[model samples]
Every structure is written in C-alpha cells, then in structure tokens.
Target: MTPRTPDAVTVFGPDFPFAYDDWLTAPEGVGSIPPEHHGAEVAIVGGGLSGLVAAHELLRLGLKPVVYEGARLGGRLRSEHFGGPDGPVAEMGGMRFPISSSTFFHYVRTLGLATAPFPNPLTPASRSTVVDLEGETFYATSLDDLPDLFREVADAWDGALDRILHLGGLQAAIRRRDTGALKAIWDALVPLWDDRSFYDFVATSEEFQALSFRHREVFGQVGFGTGGWDSDFANSMLEILRVVVTNCDSDQHLIRGGADQVPRGLWSRRVDDAAHWPEGTSVESLNGGSPRGSVTGIHRVRDSAGTATDRIAVTDESGETREYPAVLATCQSWLLTTQIACDEELFSQKMWMALDRTRYMQSSKTFVMVDRPFWNDVDPATGRHVMSMTLTDRLTRGTYLFEEGPEDPAVICLTYSWMSDALKMLPHPAERRMELALEALSHIYPGLDIRSHIVGDPITVSWEDDVHFLGAFKGALPGHYRYNHRMYSHFVQQAMPPEERGLFIAGDDVSFTPAWAEGAVQTSLNSVWGIMAHFGGSSPATNPGPGDLFDELGPIRLPD
Candidate 1:
C-alpha cells in the first residue's frame, strides 16, 4: 500500500465547512480558573454512545464519573426534526438495526425500548446491469439466487458467484492451509476481493450486467476506489457482505423517533441522578488546579440552539475549573487526542506514528416526508428491487431503499455516499444534498411531486465535519480493531509515571461490535472496568477493558 498523506484538517461541507485552522485552537491555553468548581474520580468526555456507556457503567459499579459533553446527550443517535416550523420527527442518521446485532438485541431488551421489525423496499431503483446481470434485485435475498443474478454480468462475476455458491466443505478448508476450491471458479475473485476498487469491482463483476438505465446507481454507487487506491480507508467490503449474507435470519428494526431512543432508555433506567438537560444548560464555572497545563474542569460549550445558556457545560456558565482523577473520552478517538489536553500520552511512539492510519470524509443525508407512500420500479441499472436507489445519472450513489416509517409510513431518506460512488457529487456548496435528493426522487416518482406527496420539504444534514464528531456512527476503519488490540496498553500508559490515567476512552469506536447501542454498552463497560481495575477490581470477560482492546497476539499463518 502507498503512504497516504497526513491530514489533520477537515473542511465541513454542509454544516460547518470552515477549515480546522478557522475554529481549531490548541487545547493548551494560558488562562486562570474561577473559584467554585472542584472534583475527584473520573471524567467522561463526549455524551455519545461510548461516553454515556462508560459513564453509566462506571455509575453502575458504584463509581462517580463526572461526564463532559460538548453537546447534549444522544450524540449521533440524534433525531432530525421536520415540519410546522418546530421540526417534525425524522431520521437523519442510522435509521435501523440489523438482526445480526445480538449484543444490540439484548441491550434493546434491557432498555425496554419499543421496536418494530425493519422494513424491506416497497419500491425498486437498483440497476441490475451494475450489481449483477443475473435475475432480479431479490437475487441478493438468498445465496441460492446467486446464479440468477450472476448469469449475465460477467464471466468473472458469474464465476465468483459460482464460487460463493460452492460454499460446501469450505468450512473445513478454512482450518486447512489450502483449498483449491477457492480457485476452482473464483480465480478472478481473489484479486478483486483483495484489492479491487469498489467501482472497478462492480464494473468488472457480473453484477454490472444486472443493471439498467432505470437504476444503474444502486450497485455502481456502493463501490468506488475514488481518491486513488491509496485513498481507501479500511478493507471491509467483504466484511460488510458478511453482515448482510450471514444475516439471513436477522431482520432489522427501527425506533419511533430516532436511534437515540436506545441510549435515552438506557439512561432513564440506569444511572442515579443523571444530570441531563431539559432543566438547565451550560456548565457555568470550574474550580480546580491544573494537573499540568490541561484544564480539568466543567466545559462551558454551547448546546442545541447554538446557545451557551441552560445547556450543561463542563463548568458553570461563567467558566469554572474542576478536576478528576481520570476522564473517559467517547467521541472519535482523534477528538480526545487532539481536543482535550491529557498531560500524558496513552500510546507509545509506534502507536503515535500510526495515528495516520485513519481518515474521515463527509456523507450527506436528506429526509423527505410525503403525503402518501410513493413507490417505483427497481432500477435495472443496479439490478436491485428497491425503490430507495436513485435512477438519476448524477454522481454520488444514492441510498438503498430499505424501509419507511412504520407509523407514518410516508417518509423516506436518500443517502449520498460521495466516497463510494465512482464519481464525486456536484460541488454545489449550498443546497447540494437537498437538490440531489429531490431531483433523483423526482426521476422515479414524478407523480407524487415532491411538492405535493411531500408533506414537508427536505431536511438536510451536513454534519460530517463538525467538532462534535457528529457523523462517524458507523464502524471504524478495518485495522483500528486489529492493530490496536490491546486496550490494556491504554491502562498501562496511565499506570506509568507522570500522565497517570487522567484520560479515559469511551464510545462505540472501541468495540469488536460495530457502531450500535450494543457496542457502546460494551465499550462503556470495559472502559469503566479499566478504571475500576486501577482502583482495584477486575472486568467481566464479556466486557474486557483496555487489556482486551490492545491485546497482542501471535500470527496464525507463518511463512508459507
């Protein structure tokens, strides 16, 4: 792999599109503290899944964790509102959960959050010519359907599908050193699986033949090697497939308002005297001595309405100083590393050097509410039987039409993944996403007329680059989990000398589980346990701490 350029700056596109230099300031500041705020024990950063989980877990274990969030709770699990000038409810982020998420399932039960089964596409927009030229879009519905979907796309594609269909006895081959079966019909697959750009993989695969002009987007949109091969972040196309393919029995689910309901339910049931908003906002003041140059106090950051009042700030509204023995960070790992000052370094030189391993990008979202359920034929281009796929010729692949509002059942969303589509989207600085969504939807449902079936205009969300670390609710890049296997190393660094365990990690970012409520709970449990262990206690096996996060291991296959 070629070396990727280092980028510490991200220009927010729709939300806060300014360069880092504009708003970013060193965590270090030469300021004095107020006289009121003081503290002890652990401080948790971010109110997102990871942060809240860690805080609640610590609280469950009889530990007092002072939680600091730049924004209100329910991080990315937020609800996007529309309608009536006060914003009617709609989903802007993660809309549903899959059945394969067992951990998440148990957590949902524990929280007692009401759920409805995930919905399938009522309309089709996927281009069969792109995904697979085989049969119909439902070909993806079952493994046996592969031949149908693979027939005309490409010999290479068909051969790959045949190889997949021949999964018999391969379980035994997994343990074995070699298997000729993989190469029998899949000679072209290994190369593509290992390194083909999503775009090239689709173009060259039998799937592309499945597409038609009506919907060439569904398949073409998902695969892209855009910024050059080096630009790809992690290798997880096959893994993503695993989630879908292996999840045959696992149906999906959606909450009423937003995904945030899961976390809110958890908080409402557990945690004592949880100091959440709705009453007051802003952390007025702080009263603490600087550990080093880092300010260990209540943060007085702004809230929902962009106001600094009423919202809970780390300190009093006026700015006060406080202290904690340790702090658990829950947002993106980079946020805690850069935004907050932790006098000590939790990672070694080697780990620090590899910090360049990850990169993030902007993905825009739009939710449109309609008067009636608008349906369309599946796109022949991508070969999928879903109405959510865009039938437009524009760049930036649109989203898969998964489900609709179970209650209202009249709203829909379109996700434009800029990084995935073989082409980048138009550079319309202002209404880019909204315009795209409206235009694309109109291509298929010209009758509903967005202005008519649409109960409300589109609500846009351009938050990928916000400091709140708003958009990364999905899984982390591939190697973050494998390479940083030893979460114990984090505790080790804290245990070592000057820095101590002042900085704690929280959030779904740290998990064998991907981005979901379950992963957040596990991350929180393990992180809290790490703190408890320091104070003298052990963690549950199911929820291992840093010890598990960074555990080193021996190689499986040696020099062959």
Candidate 2:
C-alpha cells in the first residue's frame, strides 16, 4: 500500500470533481461583475465561515455585501477563551482540520494563522494513546504495540474497504485528479451504497463476517482515524466512503490560536485588490464594522402587475427591509423553516423538501483549562505518562490534551462525542459534564487526579440545544441522496424560473461532504459563481468557476 501524504489527497470531490483551489488562486481572480452591479448590495444572511468567504470574494468582485449575523461570527468554528483575550481557549466546535482540506487551508494560510498536528489516537503527534474498553486498558505509542486483536480488527477494516469499495483505486484516482476515473468509479457506487447504512456494509462484508462479533464491536468502539464510528453506523455508506476516499479522517491539525480565526480573519482582512472598494476595504468595513441584526423575513418584491421581480427583500430584526439583487443564505437549513419566514415562492417545492429533509447530527464537547500540561508527568511504576490521549466506550468517548508551552496554561477537551454519545451529556450543565467526564477518566487512570490540574471554569456545548444552530452538521441517512443532490445543485440558477432565482444557499450541509470546513469553503465558492452569473458576470478565460463546468462534472442524479 502507498503511504498517504498530506499534500497528495484533497477534498476534490467524487461528487463534483472541480479544482476550486486553482480557480481561487488564479491570477485573474474569481471573476468580474458588470460595472452597473459594481456597488449593488448583495444580502448575506449569515456571518459564518461560508457567509464570510462568499462576502469577501463578492467584495473583491466589486459587489457590496450587507452581512447579517444573528448570534455571532464564526458559527460552528467557535472558540471560547477561558480567561482574558490572551488566555487559553476551549474550542467548543471544529477543533480538528485534515490537511486534505486544501481549499480551507488556502484561507488558513492566507490569514497568516498557525497550526499543529492534532493528537488523534495512536498518532505520532500524541505522546501516547490509551484505549480503555470493557474495563480493560492498553497503552501504546503505535498500532504495532497494541494487542493482536487490535491489529486483526484494523486489517479487517482495510480488507473490507479494499474488496468492497475499491478504496485504493478510488483514492489513487482522487490523488491523480483524474476526473474520468473518479466519476466512473464514484457514480456507480453512489447508487449501490447510497441506500445502505454504514453498519450494513460492515456487517455484510465478507471480511468482517469471517471475524468474531467482538472484533466488530472493537472496530466500532475504537475505529480508525479519529475515534469511534458506532455513532455514525446509521449514516449512509456513501458518506463514510467519501470521508475515507478524501482522507478527511487522517493527517488532521488544529489551528494555533483557534479555528474561529479563519472566519473572523476573512471578515476583518482588507482586500487590497478589490475592484470598486477602497484599498483598506473589508467585509467588516462594508457592513459598517459589524453585521446587521438577525434576519426576520425574506420576501420577493413584486412589480405593480403583481409579477415577481429580480429584487429580493430581506427584513431584519429591527423591522428594516432592504432589497438586493441577490441573497446568499449560509445559515443552518432548518433555520429557514424555524427562525426566518422565507417566502414560499423563493424556492421550488422540491428544493423546499430537500431543505426540510436535511438531517443534522448532534455533537457535544466539554473543555477545561489546566494549570499546565500536567498529563506529561510520568509515573514511576508504569514508566508511562500519567494520562494519555484517551478513547473509550465510557461516557467520555474521546479526550484530547492540548499544550501551548511548559510555562503557559493548557486546555483539555475532556469529552468530544457525536450523535447518541453527545446526547448522553445534552441535558447536563458545563460543570456537570466536566464532572461526568472526570469520573469516566478516573476509572481508566485509577489514581490520576485530573481535577487537581484544573485552573479555570469548564466550558461545554450541545449544538442541538442552541436554537441558532439546531445541530452540529449534516449526516446524510440512507435513501436521502436525491434530497442532497437537490440542495447541492440549487446554486446553478440557469435552469430555474425567475422566482426561484436570486436566493442562493451555501454551507457544509448543502455540500456532498458535510462537517468539514472544506465543504463550507467549496460551497461558498459555488455560490460566489452563481451570484456573479446572476449579476451578468463572467469568469476569466484563464480560469473558469464551478458553475462553468458544473453541467459536465456535476453529481450524478439518483433516480427518485
């Protein structure tokens, strides 16, 4: 097997194989709009990463972007500081980023932010990994050091993927950027796997069925890459295959300051090459240094003859309504139905069904600031670090330790769980969640006093409970591929009726690969192209956008 290189693979899409990175970095820039629409305000409904990315690019393309954010900037890329501005932060959401996310890294590097390898289970970045399951504990620096059962389970997964999904060939095609080979392989698998669940694939596979049930259980509890996969067992196999083929699970890193910096940076950073705006102009400056209040309603303005026009009217919380040539919605799909009152005519019934059926997975993370990286202290009897990066079937499914410096305070993600595991702590408060996490860890490290190292109050978040964001990210279920296709392809308005045009949607949920920042960045670029085309703009001859090649390379439509 070929060793995976961080730069070799990217989220270039088995669904839509477009080189967004090249298009973005093109010398000609994203594209140019007509002089008539140079300063025409385009309403951006959310201030999250997707919204901010689209706003920044639109600003550079000579469009006036009026950003409206309900709660705060950064959305799911939230990082909460424990003490002062310079204090340690608890990443409430989006802590790890895979190096395969090239488009996302484009923004990260452009913003001058720093990053380091995340301490995933058994990774070299982690000093050691401790796997505790069924009240048994094992410590290992590498996979080779673990028991034979561990290696057997790992081999079974590799064998199953290669035999069933043609993992190696598919990944090779992705790495080579061979669109023909990619589409040939992926389009066939889409129909075959989209209607099946991840668990079904594992259970029905010859490799896993030949092994004991214990091996399958162990595989789910301590899965490859990040951690457990049992939570995602019910998700469509297509979703799991995308993650594996794109390398979204491995070679991950965390931003030095926080993940939130990417969005906040895009919001404040001045685009010196802006077409119409001044040299120091930014998304923040264009929106008066802060975004407008929450959007209350989105309606279509009609002419005196009662015919819908091109203008879309957006009403803010303050009761002020403004008309814009285009409106980009980057908020959670459910919000369009729950919080905002969107006009029925804005989207077709099929598109509305897609939006309403989009499912979001639940997630909860608890963090605590420690006095120092005390976990590095070694135990005389065991000759191992006091406590290593932990993965367990216990309440605390995963625990990650972060160190800034020996002298500076550190942060520990006591628990990071998704789906059912996240729901276990949903009803608890921050302090209680920390207590439960500590109690779970105590059982693994018999005498380790993790609470003694704590210096600040604990921070916790259950994304589902937050009304602004109903869930963490989209987790497509079996038989929902058609719905996903509808949402993802909505940006191309060339075939849409006049009433169904102008309002665009971009976010990770609307993408084929959700829960990754790369999806948000890619979808935002798609909307940028869609909005530019709506305003009589065209891509450079040297570099065409996603919409330019969308018809030829768009996702395969699954029969309804």
Candidate 3:
C-alpha cells in the first residue's frame, strides 16, 4: 500500500523550530571559539546523551569539557547484556527511536551504528500482532484484520486531530520546514491545549463523542502508532499534539546491539575535524579515559571585590572543587534542588519555578532472555505463530519480542509500561516482575510455556527508584506551556544578568518534546550555542545557530 505522506516528517519544532540538523551538517560547521579560549575548561554535569553530545561538540569547537557522571556514562540509554558483553542486550531505556529524530540520527550515522525497524504493534517489522483487550484476543497481520471497532477508534482519532488540531496542515508545515506556517498553527494551540489534558481532548472531541465510551477505552488500550497511551492521558494535550504532528511515534527504529552504544561511541569517537585538539583526541582522552564523580554543589564565584563573576565553581562528591568560565548542566531538572547544592542566585525566581514545577512520569520495563526464538514456531491448531507482538490491557500492557537469529538467544521485553502500570511493578523484585508478566501473558497465549525457553537472568528497571535519576522523564502537565517556555528559552542568555549567565541547562527535561532522544540532542546543540556565545564566539553567517534567530523564530511567549 502507498504511504499517506510522501515527504518525511521531522521534529522541526512546533516550539523552537530551529533546524539543528542543518546547522550540524553545514559546510562551515556549528561555530568556532577564539584562539585565547581554545583550551578553556567547561564543566558538563552529566554523562548522558545530552551531556556527551555537548562535550563532543565543545571539543570540536576547541574547548575542553570535563564530564561528571554519578552512575554510568549512558544515563537512560542503558543496555544490559545478559550472558556477556557480546551477548544480546535488554534495552532498559529508549528502545525505539522515530525516523523524525534527524539530529539524533546524525550522530547514529556518524558513529556508524547499524539499525533495523523496531517491532511496534501492527508494523511490518513485527510480522504479526496480537491485541488482547479485556478478555478477547485477536490476531492480525495488519490493521485490516482487526474488528470494526479498532478501525473506528483509529478513524475517530484521526478525524478529531485533523478537525480540532489541524494535524495534516501542521505536519505539512513541519515537513517543508515552513517556520511561519508551523508557528501559526502551533502557537495558537499553545494556549488552547496548555491548560487541558490529553484525555480531555479525546473525551470532548466531536469525533469520539459520536462513538460509545467503549471506543475511548479501546483507544487508550490500543493507541495510535505505539500501544496504549492511557499512561499519558493526564499529560498536556499540547505534548500529545507535538508527538502526533512531528510523527515522533511513527516509523521507529532500534540500534543493533544496543542503544547505549550511541552515547558510548560519542565519548570515545575521535573528532577528525576538531580545531585545536590532536588527531586522536576524544571526550574520553580529554578526561583521561573516564568521567569524574558526581557533582554535589554548584556556585557562582565572587572576585576579590566581592562581586559575582562568570566563573562558576563545581563541587564533586569527594568535596573537590573546580572553577570554570562556563558550566552546562545536562542532568535531570530536579537534581539542581535535590542532588546538587546549586546557589539560589544562579537562576531567576521564575526560572527556578519552572525547574521546580517540572513533573516526571514513572516508567518500568522487565526483560528476559530465552534460549532461542521459540515464538516463531507455528501452532497448527491456530495456524499462527506461537506468539506475536502482544498488546493487552492486562498488567503486562505491552510485550515486545526481539530475535537476533534463529540460533541465537532471543530477548523478550515482557512488560514495558508507564505511570500507574509502572508504579505497580516498582515495589516488586525482578523475579516477581517476570513472574507477573508471564502470568499476564498466559491469559493471552494460553497453553504456551514461556519459562521453559529462559536462557539466563531477567533484567528489570524502575527509573524513578534510581537516586541519580529522580524520574524517567518530564511529562508536561496542564498550564505547563509557560514553564516549558522558560526552560526551552533559557539557552538565550544575552538578556540575563551576569551572575546567572554562565550556568546553562540542556536535556530532554528542558526541551518541549521530553522522553525522546531528539529532544536531548536538540537541547544539547542549543547549549553548545549558548556556551559558544558565552565565550565570544559566533556561528557563521551562512549557518546561524538557534540563538542567532531567537528574536524572530523563538517560541512564542504567553502572558503572565
């Protein structure tokens, strides 16, 4: 069948709309610093994808980046190998990435990582899908095989989106990089949706209202693109709109081996085009092959005259202090108040309110490695594969199967759930979680013995339980547009006071599209621009950065 849209959709901001992919791939490169500041040190507090991206780019711009990671290098891009380093991995976080994430794919291409289509429900990659809602099980190779109710729900959603939100027009604007048209559509949506929940949008829309309440329930369980968005029903409708219009959930892919390789590759990859650094220089070699300890405090330094300066002091967990001319904090937003002792004067009260008000949604995943891809075996009675990518309203919610090869051990993500579902598994151990997932799946695939094919230990993760990362990722609540605007626009510091100038932030939490790696990459580029301008550097006129066009193309501001 032919695709709906011929042009590929990109995350070209319904918010900032800056073309980061173009800036990174420009002939002149991002920007350059003065020779005097070639070797100036910049502190990056977090070794996640965002921090690593900033560090990698900063090195190319002829600056030294000192990265401090409390736990591991790849924060949420964690991949847990089952048997050994070369064995199959269970991607605990960020398993699937959409094709619209151009900025992120830039790094993936540069790093030479191989990728394949992820097995989302109803996708060709999964081959077949089994959707078991309430107690009924249906097997299908595509959406056509599903019942009329499923199609009705899908059609209702599309109708509601196009009618209420102008989905197609906004997406066309994003695809063509028409900033004015995109903003005209999205800016109007900011106030309209910022104060409303996603559930409210669906419940109140004329399309779903025409159908029975059961349609809404089915819509939540078997959502569009990915499975079951009921977990995000409480999120702002603007957030949901951004995901839909930008195609953040469609045409997704997974990095072969593991997603963590992206960040780790950036850390160790040599920068051939780096300015002042030598041929073999990398973020790893710059920091002596490893990141520093956790940061405990951050303060703006005062000179002999007792006046605040651009120099910022960073204190590690060992109580060792180092001063830098600029500091880019890419950690979770709550860390500033909870984990780190940041000075009150570093951020304005309004900025502080934005940071403090940021809400994070919980997420949990349980994975088990099996001896082989037994699920591919045929069931003569049912004339279907023993198992298919399963989506159910049961406790498991969504179960994904990953097959490396027929002979190789296969990895099964038993349960990938969020919000209330994730919270339910938080208190349970990995063994108990696996047991609960297997029991739930048994209801869908009765008479199938899943435990017999187990190869090794099961892997489980509750992101909120981790101290270093307070929560999985930010979920913008109702009336959060103002807060999101504050954080997203914080990169442009020319108008800010000197004391709050050098301390910048970058991460998915600080971006409009949180919980996506594209957001992390884009925000990191923004901070790179902010840090560049901090040291008297500028992007080439041909390839002006986000900050250069902030006055005209930045996110629209709402009244106080």
Local distance difference test, candidate 2: 0.92
Residue-level lDDT tens digits of model 1 in 60-87: 4445556455666677777766554333
lDDT order of candidates, best first? 3, 2, 1
Point out where model 3 deviates above 4 Å: 1-6
Per-residue lDDT for 14-128 in model 3, tens only? 8888888889988988899898999899999999999999999999999999999999999899999989999898999898999889889999988989999999999999989
- The residue pairs in collision within model 2 are none
Per-residue lDDT value at 59 in model 2: 94
Write the residue-wise lDDT of candidate 2 on 1-560 in tens digits. 11234438889898999999889888878899999889999999998999999999999999999999989999999989879877887888888999888889989888999889998999988889999999999999999989999999999999999999999988888889899999999999999998899999999999889999998899999999998899999999999999999999998999988899999999999899999888999999888899999998999999999988989999999999999989999999999999999999999999999999999999999999999999899999989999999999999999999998987899999999999899999999999999999999999998988888899789999999999899999999999899999999998999998999999999999999999999999999999999999999989878989999999999999767
Model 3: lowest-lDDT 10 consecutive positions: 1-10
Better of 1 and 3 by lDDT: 3
Point out the higher-scoring one by lDDT: 1 or 2.
Answer: 2
Give the TM-score comparing model 2 with the true structure, all chains together.
Answer: 0.98
lDDT of predicted model 3:
0.93
lDDT of each: 0.42, 0.92, 0.93
Per-model TM values vs. the true structure: 0.61, 0.98, 0.98
The C-alpha RMSD in Å for every predicted model, in order, reads 13.5, 2.0, 1.9
The residue-level lDDT of candidate 3 at 357 comes to 100
